[model samples]
Target chain A: MPNSTDTPSNDTPSNDTGSFNPTARSRVKRLHERGKYDEASVFAILDAAFIAHIGYVIDGQPFVTPTAYWRQGQTLYWHGSAASRMLRFQEAGVPACVTVTHLDGLVMARSGFHHSINYRSVMAFGMAKLVADPQEEAAQLDLFVDRLYPGRRATLRPNEPQELKGTTVIAMEIEEASAKTRSGHPKDDEADYALDCWAGVIPIHQVVGRPIADPLLKAGVAFPKGLAGYRDGARFDELLTTNMV
Target chain B: MPNSTDTPSNDTPSNDTGSFNPTARSRVKRLHERGKYDEASVFAILDAAFIAHIGYVIDGQPFVTPTAYWRQGQTLYWHGSAASRMLRFQEAGVPACVTVTHLDGLVMARSGFHHSINYRSVMAFGMAKLVADPQEEAAQLDLFVDRLYPGRRATLRPNEPQELKGTTVIAMEIEEASAKTRSGHPKDDEADYALDCWAGVIPIHQVVGRPIADPLLKAGVAFPKGLAGYRDGARFDELLTTNMV
Candidate 1:
């Protein structure tokens, strides 16, 4: 999601448009047209969701940990206890592959070979950076609150250091990445289209139900105005994307 | 998601129950209570979702690929072009981590430290196995079509050899795995409950909209009975879970 951080992968070959250079490891090999290397496109896909599956290695075994993540400037961050194996291993600046995906539709093609999916996904490669500086950690902790509830940070009680004492946050600079997306109806073979089988797109959407207030909430407290956008039926990605804009 | 693949990790201590014995790498380290090693629990979580992020390594660089996947017996399968880098690299039985997650709610807390998420996630680890035999590949290919569309496989045209000529299917026996879940309302600090800040949960749901038929569908075509289970407003997980049941 590096809009201005478009300093292409070191000395790799980048075209004039400021897109990421397709290195041997980062290029999309299949269905090449669906691959996107531009920062704006990558960032939009990244911002649409706060959840990601982080791929990292411990020994030779690869582990994909699904966690809530946030992006600030060119860096990406996720949190866990200081005791977490992932956080502990990442402190030494291990390579990390952070991937976020939004599956949008069920594509039912006339033939099994043509069936596909519609999704928006961003796969980023980078070295994990542990926020060891106390000041940087404190600042980032505050930014995490604003990720979803933008201006509400000013109104909420501050986190007690002890409350989050053992937690650690890890960051990555999105060194090299690609965004891949597919949408719309399925593409069937020309001959198969004439078959009577039903073939179409069943669009999938993640929507929010009405917010349930805490039972012990104060008498005069109303739903935070900063979070009014999270109404019933509000689309999750739309809320995050709107906040990005 | 294995119900009968009950053999625990070799030489690892396990209680009387048939759940997978947690080894050094497979155990959930943080919130101990949320980790479920029993087969039924793990399979339910895995069956509820059809998409997974696979973590695999090429060189020392890890890559996370989000793909559509299906489960049968104790094995998990996902497909791609035979020439795809991820598939080609995984053909040699690489150590892979497949993770599936359902993010259910956003927990808004009175204090930043108490904020959390309600989610159901499954992580499976095993060596990748390429389905190389032609007959085995053909059978698995047929199973893939039925994963989402159930009995509609009987109504569709068979895939031409050339249609899927270069595609490959990869399988991994889910040797060791764990399911993690969290639900219910926000757990805020006792003193923070008296604060005026809003604290609650915005429940998330993935639902289907009305299915759109292909524009070129024949005039006499009707929605297939096998797919009638998929209707407007059906929950994506519910659809899959029901089929699994």
Candidate 2:
């Protein structure tokens, strides 16, 4: 008999309901078996990543802009100077492709050529729209701050009217999405078992180090207690996502 | 007295002389200050990375393609199956931008808002063209093998006619390029010092583990020396480009 833990869930909600919506998987990858097209899985990957590469067309030329982003439900938001050229995409209703990838570790296979990365990534396709509602935009803006540092939204002065005018919030409702990931150790051939080669994950990690104080900070400002003792290591995204929000 | 090492060369070569051609500082990273653009410095960052996000267009919609790539001189190469949709971009003479970034470490600053990555990235913008010459195509194909594994070009069988026909090789000249880098510890403000926050860099690294043997390999085929003891850490592109052909 197989191990009890190895069985697949028979009654889990299909891709349409619950947290299992895998919408777009075919165009992005050849081996669909390894791709996870579910909405929850896709959102987890996107939220875990701190940076995104947003691609858009400007006057018939293509440009890829790398910036920071945050997600709320099915909507993704990115902020920048209102005068920024990227904001123009939102004004025109142009289709934009936003992508996020987290490189967890490098995978070394028995075959030198099969080396890969242990990563989680999401490619979201959608048409971007400018967030114009004052209350909704303010909530999204606070979410961006909360995403960067948890529980500190009330510590600072609220956004003034001019500050809001100088900032643009562009959002996209994820229409098509796909995620591909590779994890685990090397998959070697049977005959090469006896070969004297070190084979195991070297273990890549992104740890949080001690924080550096800013040069211009006022002398009496104390460090936030929440940021103390942060170490660089892998944490499951589920727990991380909850804590971050 | 100022250090002698900081001075510029007194002599400038004539335009016709080979010496007059200033060393190409990895054309992709021209945005950085000269001191930060050395070949070893730039290559070190490139080798420790994999999977560049490529941006291009189809119709008026922008598309970002994540693909595996290798660099040679001032040119970068990527290929896919002939039938792949990505191949059509090269055939159509459209411009594309490719970016490769190595996330070396995480920046933890006194203020959570200023946190960032210590990264080395190269962005190349140019038109991509497909390789058509049969002999040149064959040479470039061999270059790919030699690139993936240092000593395998002579050992592996040449690409059969069918394989050649099924693959498409596209090369980009890396026209407008820039490499931006942020390294070292966090840059925090002075007032945050007394806050007793620990500020530093969590150095992230990619290391290769032991290789797995292929399951279908013949019982007696020994692992080649070139394939053994390969340390594929975070600096993947740097390793592949510098030592390989």
Candidate 3:
């Protein structure tokens, strides 16, 4: 584990700024006050969900692929088919950017110019390379499953031989990172607050729908307790954070 | 307007494949069957939301920035502060990829190997250029508002003089693009269906919460009908699609 993120802070002034030193790439140039470099702040954004938009370059053309992602300590992990062309290009230790965003609400300012969205986002820059070892790769897969589902891995059938060979896991230790967030009501001009207009937030949320059982499942098979966190109407990110071990 | 996206197709096999020809850069090599090449397929995915992850490279490093986005005919648009570093970097007609994804559901299979998430996503590759013309830039900003909120543009206060110069809008014509989508239940191995496991799809939907009135709003200010589509329980993407012109 990297000492920067893993070590407990002393609550000093330096820790407030964070242990992850901002670089030219990770720095927030516009509205710099919103930038957060603390490990706790960055990890909270990453742990809230398992989806990420990975940015990478093949030749000079950039491609952004949205994929499932998880973080353990300071290392970020994502997997895809071993035969995947994108994975092949990334396994060569490519420089990559992984970004996660959560849309909170829409801020309706009195004027069209002040309209904005409330959100929390993190952008982590790192070098991505393959987890080539079979034993290590298998463990990472288990983490991906158990991380979201808690104890679900123990109840499921084991991976088949072909399944083992077909999956490719990529690991990237975050070298530079930054988190940006905006929340609460719109910050309109002081005078505009008195305008005769409907100005407020229409909050946005990702909620859980009912869990559907497969048609072919055994009649007696109960809904797995491991995934009990997915109950209907629950907040999606909160459930993930609640289940995060 | 480009005939490929605008002209009605005759339901021929080629038209079903899409009017947008797949190139080496935009082709979906893995799961080729899931790849969509036609203009309608690509535009549907793009119009479903106002957010996109833009992939652009600086020097040899890649950066993915999530920003509000809108589509008009063959072109796509997004805006940010004029002083924004990412916007400045992209204003020079830089090669970029704009990706939009909607998480639809979580598919739980009998085995961990078959577990997957259902999603609809589009990747459009193009050269991003600044909308330098003040007249065109102003209209695009209005379109951005009225696009999501319908006629909300007319009810609001006019833009300030500084707001015009403070915002930078970027436009990218869809040069090469592809849409990949997966839906429904888990397609597990046929034999695994007999396993004593609860395998099904837990549907995921982005829903709207209650609209919050600004604390400072006047008592008589009514909720705009243009934004009535944002009522609670409406699916966010569907609402955006409904409001889309």
Candidate that scores best on TM-score: 3
DockQ-sorted candidate list, best first: 3, 1, 2
> What ordering of candidates by TM-score runs from best to worst?
3, 1, 2
Please tell me which model should have the higher TM-score, number 1 or number 3: 3
Error of 3 at A158 (Å): 1.3
Docking quality of model 3: it rates as medium
| Reference-based lDDT, each prediction | 0.81, 0.59, 0.83
C-alpha TM-score for every candidate: 0.91, 0.72, 0.92
Task: Give candidate 2 misplaced runs (Cα > 4 Å).
Answer: A1-29, A103-119, A152-165, A182-229, A235-245, B1-48, B104-117, B154-157, B184-245
Best by DockQ: 3
Give per-residue CA lDDT, model 1, range A3-83, as digits (tens). 111112111223444566778878886776677888777777888898999999888889999988999867899887888
What are the per-residue Cα lDDT tens digits for candidate 3 across B23-134? 8898988767677878878887888877899999999999999899999888999998888888899899999999999898887878888788878889999999999999
TM-scores for chain A over all candidates? 0.90, 0.82, 0.91
Clashing pairs in 3: B18-B38, B19-B38
Poorest stretch of ten by lDDT in candidate 3 chain A: A1-10
- DockQ numbers for every candidate? 0.71, 0.23, 0.74
- The prediction achieving the highest lDDT against the true structure is 3
User: Which CAPRI tier for candidate 1?
Assistant: medium
Give lDDT for model 3.
Answer: 0.83
Q: Positional deviation of B219 in candidate 2, in angstroms?
A: 6.5
